[model samples]
Target: MGNGHGLVTLLLGAILMGASSFVQGNSSKHVVCYQGTWSVYRPGLGKFGVEDIDPFLCTHLIYAFLGIEETGQLRVIDAYLDLEDNSGRGNIKSFNALKLKNPVLKTLVAVGGWNEGSKKFSVVARDPLKRAKFVDDVVRFLQRHGFDGLDLDWEYPNQRHSLENEDRSNYITFLKELKEGLEPFSFMLSAAVGSAQFSAELSYDIPAIVPYLDLINVMAYDLHGPWDEVVGINAPLYAAAGDASDSTGRMQQLNVDAIVKYWLLAGAPPEKLVVGVPFYGRTFTLTTPDGNQPGSPHIGKGIAGKYSREPGVLGYNELCELMQQEEWTQKWESAQQVPYAFRQRQWVGYEDTRSLSLKAQYVMDHHLGGIMIWSLESDDFRGTCGQQRYPLLHEINRVLFGANTPTGLTQESSDDKPSEGFRCPAGAPEGYVRDPDDCTKFYYCSGGNTHSFNCPVGLNFDLSTKSCDYSSSVKC
Candidate 1:
């Protein structure tokens, strides 16, 4: 799925005019978490869980939510919850379980997800003692399971299913207690927050939780995909003007840039923000609303695997299974750097090697924390894992960490440039202010040397190019 990207022009302008101020992050040496998802607990897999690693992609592995504590008993709750039939233990495990050793990989347990545990959390967050007990239980569970941390995925705090909602202030109090409760165990605390709209309504309360969390994983996807009357992007790199307009209604959606900026402006630390990217794509059926032709009934929804005609959402495993059985054509949208496929009258939108590459670039360009993959199991294992292709993980590690990971995609050299050259158009005015976070090379005549612009102290400037190197310690 894709969303509107109004900010592309501005991002492009920023690349062109602010080339000099472009900062190169030391992500190569930094510890970026690649939160892998284990949808449901599958027993025998042990730590390998749902996703059998083709190769290590992240520094951390995040297990999905452990359901609510109800009736004095706590149990895993989720629809399509995958559990090991014979073995009682959930599949989530340590890095060793996945057979990864190079960079340290810590497993974090997620609690209270989406519709499944919302009502239960509402009850716990209201009472301090109940909340404290929940935290204790969480710690005990982690210790028993050998997990390193906890991620809270409460869909929303105060907001309700309808316009009438509960008190929003209680969230801050709940987070404070949760933080205090987890302090003794010295565990990392994280929260999965909704996008801008829900975040605002629910009062993300980032200020109160900052001291308690190592980072916040932003659920930046779901901006668009099959839910709307017409086609739209699942996620956009930049906000576009025509998005949500008649001409672009078929393409309206959300962008990563705006979401990140919004979070930062809302007080989220950029370094402490792990951007979420979906490994799967969304799908929609198309029929000319103006014309009489009837579109497929499943117009705005997920297509199964890469087959456009197929119906419904296919998790990573489902998609992988489909890939093994079919041959599908691929197309890449330059504006979004995302891939999609079309067959007959059906359309499927998903990520490809090229789109993923751009996504990595976006994370680095913005000096944002690391990238987060929804689920590692969805990748083309044979294509991305074996000695030959090393598909998704290979490209991710190579681009983000500069690790010598092997991949089939062309590794961007230190000298790659955008096809249109970095210069602004001839007739463009000179005073345009450019963003310093563009990955492409660019030019600007806005003012005094763009390269020489003053940077916040503690940031290092390389004399060779006058660009800032923000890999290690740099004041924002």
Candidate 2:
């Protein structure tokens, strides 16, 4: 997902951009929180709350994204019977524990992440009946879990891996049907999007899909991965030019902020977009200048970490334990406000309380909806990291939502300031245009004259038509 060779270049680019805190304009004010499920599948991990970690960590989260498997034998496809019941009946105890603690927490089951969800989604979305069955099954699953909504993390639509074409039209049809079927429950629908520029461009017709969804979870992390060579960049705010920051001394690539802006400009409403934060760090073994230099080059395997690995990625759980054991020292990068560490010839990049605190600030400053973590169980409940307190959820609430409690998360009163400096265009309504000079950037001509312009971007704009084309893109 990212490159080691591009790390240095992106890092330098970020530095040049200056580490200023983001400030939100009037349009970006929605926030949704998320938590993934893989850690729950492991043995002996359920009593996360009772085990020392803050049982109430998820209490203030506006929405928690749970993962589910689409199991099958005969594909009976009842709108209610399609979801695998593991996180449902089997995991009720844990979920109920969370719900009882925080009544306002909205839990949405996310179906199909990176590797495990494509097959079933492809099958169900292609056929009307199967799609119906899936929608019905999803509804049933929600009712069974007492869930507040559903998030379609279909990894991709009309494409395999990273390539997609005409089949994309079929993808929207599937969403339209799902949206129609789930309307009765007022179910919240959202989709997890890729952070890579190419992936975002061709993956989904977001503007077309906006009508069918409540939010779009922009998976803003994983810009870099183990597969890349030369001390790779995990994530960057700007794409690197050449070989500026790595083992090859070549420019690193991928600009996360650009991805965010792309979606914003493409019609995805800022309020409906949730930014993703990884609960783990991609790991790589690097050759050192002298075994003491943390910025060494790779020598071995590039893998994900759990607890501890000299040459692999480290999941949040392991990272928390390390913080507690004092096994590694945490360092913060002013550039991205993310944290990284070096221990036993290994370099680990991850998020921490301070770093997360800063990110929360960024979210509020930029008016982003809220933060979304990969999985819920990765935080350290046992205080394994000492007094610094990796109160991930708490930090989010404190900084972005301005809430001391669950109710406060969504109930804050806005200042309602009138943007008096800007004026509406000659023919536009008072609030429709922010500034006379910026009208063309935000609005365009349509049916006749007065009411024809659009409100810019959302989850439903058509790329090819330069308008809202849900089915496909048309260059004309």
Name the regions of candidate 2 deviating beyond 4 angstroms: 1-38, 41-89, 93-97, 161-164, 233-253, 289-296, 300-311, 323-330, 388-390, 408-476
Best by lDDT: 1
Per-candidate local distance difference test: 0.52, 0.50
For model 2, give the 10-residue run with minimal summed lDDT.
16-25
Model 1 segments more than 4 A misplaced: 1-51, 70-73, 77-90, 93-103, 115-117, 160-167, 197-203, 244-253, 288-302, 306-311, 314-329, 384-390, 404-476
Query: TM-score per candidate, in order?
Result: 0.66, 0.66
Q: Write the per-residue lDDT of candidate 2 for residues 1-476, one digit (tens) a residue.
A: 01221233223222211211111122123335454333333444322332232323342232233333333212321222223354333343354334322222445666666655455566656567767777778777666556556677777765574234444666788778878876776666777777655776666777887788777778877776555554444554444444354464223325456677777788877777677776667666657624422234677555444433335666666766655676665565555546667666567766666666666676666666766766555665334555434466566656653443223311111112223333234554211221243222212211122212221222122222232222223222
Whole-model alpha-carbon lDDT for candidate 1: 0.52
Candidate 2 TM-score over all chains jointly: 0.66
What's the distance in Å from true for residue 344, model 1? Answer: 1.7
